[model samples]
Target chain A: MSEVRFGILGCANIARKVARAIALAPNATLYAIASRSIQKAEKFAAENSLPASVRVYGSYDEVVEDSGVDAVYLPLPTSLHVRWAVTAASKKKHVLVEKPAALDVAELDRILEACESNGVQFMDGAMWLHHPRTAHMEHLLSDSNSNGIGTVHFIHSTSTMPTTQEFLENNIRVKPELDALGALGDLAWYCIGASLWAKGYKLPTTVTALPDTTRNAGGVTLSISASLQWDQPNKTVANIHCSFLSHTSMDLAICGSNGSINLKDFIIPYKETSAKFDFTFGAKFVDLHIGWNVRPEEVHVDNKLPQEALMVQEFARLVASIKDCGSQPSRNWPEISRKTQLVVDAVKKSLDLGCKPVVL
Target chain B: MSEVRFGILGCANIARKVARAIALAPNATLYAIASRSIQKAEKFAAENSLPASVRVYGSYDEVVEDSGVDAVYLPLPTSLHVRWAVTAASKKKHVLVEKPAALDVAELDRILEACESNGVQFMDGAMWLHHPRTAHMEHLLSDSNSNGIGTVHFIHSTSTMPTTQEFLENNIRVKPELDALGALGDLAWYCIGASLWAKGYKLPTTVTALPDTTRNAGGVTLSISASLQWDQPNKTVANIHCSFLSHTSMDLAICGSNGSINLKDFIIPYKETSAKFDFTFGAKFVDLHIGWNVRPEEVHVDNKLPQEALMVQEFARLVASIKDCGSQPSRNWPEISRKTQLVVDAVKKSLDLGCKPVVL
Candidate 1:
């Protein structure tokens, strides 16, 4: 109980990153790792340079049932998340699952329910939210003083990563059975999360999928664009586009009444050591419509640890509070995850119905 | 003729800028000015430092019919463009009309037809297109080498300018009968033009207005967002949003299969002396998804003349080609202007029909 012992399920590529994060987190230990094949688990451990005392298992159930494992990091594919996450939570292990937590809200609800019933901490692996840069951006957006960016009127976020032909044809993400939401679930989740995060997690009144959506043969979306709208008073609209068919481009811009903020590398900063964003206040063209009177101010945030490690450390702190101090699990992380999942579900539904607006 | 003699009509606010451009254009001479009242025209001429030889007229017809004037710059409201532009063209005066050229494509066709019959040069006053930075951007986008950004898959452009309460309530743009298209005609025209310009002026297959649209009491759109789609071989999607309710923000981002480009000041550069854009080729997250493998390269394009002056100079050069060299009028400008207006009309139709997709 002195340290948060973490067990990772699956040997997915993303799991390798999370495993490194768990090892680097000051309050966490990489206690166990499990793959379908014990040899594969051993090979992963050898390749990642895990400590000699780390346990290797052939089945995910063994990792969950191990009494020494205080928490589970589930980096399984979308189709496998529900089964493993629910199982880990039911076994009284805190759950930290990769994004697109489940195929849909219904499946994600079951995982949340299990965690609630078992009194275990639950957090989605949206690492960017834990970055110091994200906190700085939130401050810029929420500041109400003279220099602050006023009420946000619009937000646009995009996350795109082109895949190789071989991967597109064979990757689990493009297969409906493996990841039914395809690019919408894998990439759009980040865009949707960003839109929500900018608005302080306020759910939009409506969600509409743009007609430019493309889907693979298995009816899994390969690329999608959507707009989220808030009614009356605030009168805000946000647009998000995600695709596996374009080059890697992760950008987010928030425009307020008094100013705007732009981030070129929102999902992942251009560098781990430092991140930068630009903020412009009272931008106006000079007399005679020649040029702007003021240019955007560039702001930078420095971080010593990678965002994933920060995410793991933050999750471990919550688990420690629950395990050592006998405190209740933090509801903030789970609530934000649920809201993001709900918006993702709405976008999928709107796309399914031929780009119709889904009232949220 | 020693120079292309230019006449200014309506004495509108934008006319002041074009008047200075006319004076700066070496091949053009500001010969006359006209307004409904001769006093306003006289005031405009004096305020803009017009030469003593510049004559002031009370009626627009007087300026167009003056034997000394060889070209006319029409900077009137949307509803008045068709009247003044057609009149000027019919008088055999080469025409340069302000944006939202005639409120709709059908009206613009009449103005274009008048120029065709008169055998006079025709151009829409989209001044940014004349900026040296624009040609630089076009070069980067069309380059197909290993270091070049690849084929574009999507584009997003926005032009939003917040107006004061008094202006919103009393400005001619907010009046239904004057600038009937409101923000869509004034601001969204820039967004649509940027999209069309990025695609080499090829029109989209369909245009759909996003549901997040607002209209004022006078039945004029105050804010709007729309998506333009191209089908088949070169699948592309572009989104454009324009509003009079948000702070000044003009942005354009083009995402290609192998690279991408971003510009914060597309409509008007932050500075007239030099403008810059960022281009990234093969941008991808580095190991552990901690940072980008290649950051965007900042490219700056320097301009000795302001964009508006360059626009006037280009128009005068084309006018001189017909007058001094007996060359045919350049159809490129009018053609691009027509395509932009067509897309604007489609967006208006889609918004009118409750956000339905309108075929181009």
Candidate 2:
């Protein structure tokens, strides 16, 4: 493939953003887009200003089956991810499914198996992981200096996006049939993923949902908080809170024995091209305890391309490698995605079981 | 009373800071300091630059019985707070005690009873509460505007101060006989007090100690995390983590439905003269979810006196009202102190009972 041809599986609002990313990525092309309604697909393409050569399809099946389309980006609702992702994979198209990749780990397992059997690459659309800021943070957290952030002791993350009353009453996210996991799947996915990332993708020993949870009338969770614990020679704990009823905020703080990393905008940077995080090593009180001896250092990471575009570029790179080199799929992406989904499943189970601990 | 004369009990390191605060307070004076040894008391007075007129006593009983000592600033260890506080109060000296106040609520009640019988004012030494920044944040939280922070959803606080190996092994905080409550009393007291302040002093209905707790060989906790739940019509939850093993960090974030207040320095401000906190109301994502539409406003509060000095001044004002103006001792101080201790006892109970939830 001269350039990785991309096909979007839906005309969801998020698809518009990713379509632009595909157009910006040098190694990717917006080859096709599909929606349940032909007119909706055409309108989305026109509004997003897709190139004239791009094709439009009335059904998702047409896009997945298109031989020219080397990859499919599944931005469908959670309930449709398993069916559409598996279908896309079986059609020999690499899959970049948006998080929460599936309703639960079981559904994600089937999708991963389908991709493995078909020899197609699989990646979750957690765009933040592709950002340059994440790399800088990872470097600092893993630094071995005595003053650096030592062994991770705790991490806490939150993503709360407030929705209007009308949206709450009518949006697909709050509907049990559309996004069955609701806020837990849509918002908590990032929080849990961030926690796992802070811990270098190590799964926690146990997951416990806190007692404070809210659900819509349809029994879809609107808000939830859960904690994950790991015990060994050194103990570490992580807590995540996600809600659709609070003001918009995305925060992540990784506290270590020697230092800490704090970012108010973890999921999405406040600026498209630049991101910043505060890091502190061996902070102490000044004499007389009136002030700090050392203040946290704010580190800025600049990226030439937007994070979403970087995500597309990365996905296309893997696809090109596989098509040209006949290489097996990258296990890293699929493994991390599966682990994140497993934690989501455990959190849901803990919540369902009256906030009891669920051993993982 | 011409001025509130303060008697210092013991020569703990914290007492040095508080002694300076008493000297800086316009309406208070450091009249006496007592230690087990006359040499130690004299050395402390000389090292701290106490005035020549300030009396140095060989025993705490002498300071409490000194006729010129109008109040006692008891910076004793947690295990000794009850004995010294009650004795000072019973001698008709107003009591300003360092927190945890006592090991448990029962010990605090006896001190309160002694203060009531003698008509002496009582106040805990939570200096941050007196900071001007706290009042500003409180105003924003209680604002009724749609953009203001709405009803409380949760509060998360932490106070982690790293100690040297020598300090951890030899300090009174880790010694069971000297400070039995350990980090729970030394650090978590401020966390719990901050949470209660965020909720207008309404105690939580349940306190559950989280699973990640570290203890010394003497079975004294050195680090702990806990969740407090309020199950009224509008459910709320609060989490607090305190440790003596992590690098110094004091964080408090009060998240409400409409807005949030975040501060990295809540226990001790980064500066003595001024403090700042971030407040955001109804923050939203910009177009395409690339960035926030409204950034958090950094509100700075300046004070002429340091927080500790303000605490001393406030305590002295209450004492003066009772001694000179024929006013009743303020019940607010002791009431909130008792409630805070009650939650502390509950957390200790929960930690002792295999991390179970203890009903308030």
Candidate 3:
């Protein structure tokens, strides 16, 4: 329980961030890094300033074979997620997979089953959910608090980043053979995940892709918009926009009957140690509807570590509990990842049906 | 040209605000007020502290008939706009009608035609359009400057207010015979208008209503969500959510290829004299992607007069120009209102078709 050793598979650009995250996480250690080539693994370790004690492996199998590594962080391409994640899980290593979790729900389910069978902790690398600001917003969204935002009615979120022409043409994300889902996988994972999180992981009854789906020449989505509608206990609708052709933006706005919350930098904070969101409660128009009675109050939350490090630390804590105390792997994180992947699949299905509504 | 005389043709709650706006507008004067009964008009005048010099009339016709009144502000229900607006135009009075200018674009067209034939100016009472903050935002949205938000790709806006059950059942806005369109007409007008304004009045290629449309017992839409897609010289998508079921919110966020802008109180400012919006230009994730390199900068703009007063002043300026300088009536305001109404009709049509996409 002293430290859950993390072995990172693949030398993806994102893996470098996770490497730093593991180094920052007090409860987690950067034990090993693997790439298709030993030189690549060694170069990644050097570039990220990994300590000499960290192991460099030529193959992902070597990291999985190392019994000292308790967890594997899979930052591989979406197409290779199922193979590597399932292999890591089968090796009794807890899994922290980068999102879009998999190319589709089927692949995600395979990885999930492997983790469940092996009694390994599972979580997707959605670092924002680990931020202190997210917890602060969740407190306001809780149903037990009478003063919180009343029964949620609407949620809007977007994850967009401008990509250069060269990146669009050559990057792994937009390449059909590497990241087939393209922007829908790379960017919309955040937006769709945020929506599901806001709704407490209640799967939507229907998903409809907007007509504005833009595709690259290789039939990969470059930009897309979709809506998820929940028709059960209380009707709620969530709209998400994800694109690789827009300015960098990560906006999340949630409105309930009695209040609303909004944050512009929901995916990544402007600063590493602090974040803020705007919350307006019991807002009413002043007499004659000239102005609001109250303005949105800025609520600031500070964190001792970056959200990525928090994610690593939390994953390590869960893995440690299971390894040391013989506790079962918590289903909470896996369930969240499953539900988010299910919605992602639904969105893709909706698009496949020519922007028609896909009933869940 | 000293001051264009103004007359109000209803005793609705909003009329009180416009009466004050007319009084505060330097180039406009509150010359007359009208209601179904002289006693009601006199009571409204007394309650709103109207000056004794302001005339009170028993019927809307009297306000139109008064040769001294240069313009009439029609704050009547949506059902009454076409009739009153046409009558005022025929009487050589410039018309300033409250939004959802008419129940449908057909009625709006008739009203516009009447104003055109009579050589009288026409403007919708969308007060937010006249705010100094709007002009400042417009400056940032302009394509002339390379530093502004470049080629807007997505726009998201919401106009929602929590309504009491009694209001949902009895308020004129939700009553089938009074406003008819309910939240779509009353609240969505601002959101739809905002989308159009951000896009420089370019009509969307298609409109699709989300399945979360909620209706009152009288079959009036109480809440609705819709997306407008523009497929032309550039591809842009806009999502709008308007409801009488959620907490008060008027949010507008526009994301472009180079920058983004966001404001919470878009329809009405949180304060009367000043407003602020967050603008982030050239935003990029820092190396390692842990956080953004730039945060949204708060841009504040102040106005000497309330937005409503500024609206009245602008309308009066146009009216005076026509009356004193023998200038032609400007088509800009009427065209803006017409485009907005067209989109409103498209949204309603899509809802009527069971949330299908309606081609514009």
CA lDDT, every prediction?
0.89, 0.89, 0.93
Between prediction 2 and prediction 3, the one with superior TM-score is 3
User: What is residue A24's positional error in candidate 3, in angstroms?
Assistant: 1.3
Q: Say which docking band candidate 1 falls in.
A: high
Off by over 4 Å in 3: none
Please write out the lDDT profile of model 2 over residues A1-360, one tens digit for every residue. Answer: 568999998988889889888988999999999999999999998898788899999999899889999999998888999999998898999999998899998899999999999999999999999999999888877846566688888787888888889989998888999899999999999999998998888899989898889999999999888888888647788878888888777888888889998888899888898989989887898888988988779899999999999999999999999999898889999999999999999999999898888999
Query: What is the C-alpha DockQ of each candidate?
Result: 0.80, 0.73, 0.90
Candidate 1 chain A least-lDDT 10 residues: A140-149
* Model 1 residue B343 lDDT score: 95
Scored against the true structure, residue B179 in model 1 reaches a CA lDDT of 94
Question: Each candidate's interface RMSD, rounded to one decimal?
Answer: 1.1, 1.1, 0.7
In candidate 3, what are the lDDT values of residues A1-360, reduced to their tens digit? 679999999999999888999999999999999999999999998988899999999999999999999999999889999999999999999999999899988899999999999999999999999999999898888888898997889999999999899998999999898899998999988998988888878899999999899999999999999999999878999999999999999999999988999999999998998999999999999998888889889999999999999999999999999999999998999999888888888899999999999999
Q: On a 0 to 100 scale, what is the lDDT of residue B113 in model 2?
A: 98
Q: After superposing candidate 1, which stretches have Cα over 4 Å from the reference?
A: A143-146, B143-146
Which 10 consecutive residues of model 2 chain A have the lowest summed lDDT? A139-148
Best by lDDT: 3
- Report model 3's chain A TM-score: 0.99
TM-scores for all candidates: the values are: 0.98, 0.98, 0.99
Query: Considering every candidate listed, which one attains the maximal DockQ?
Result: 3
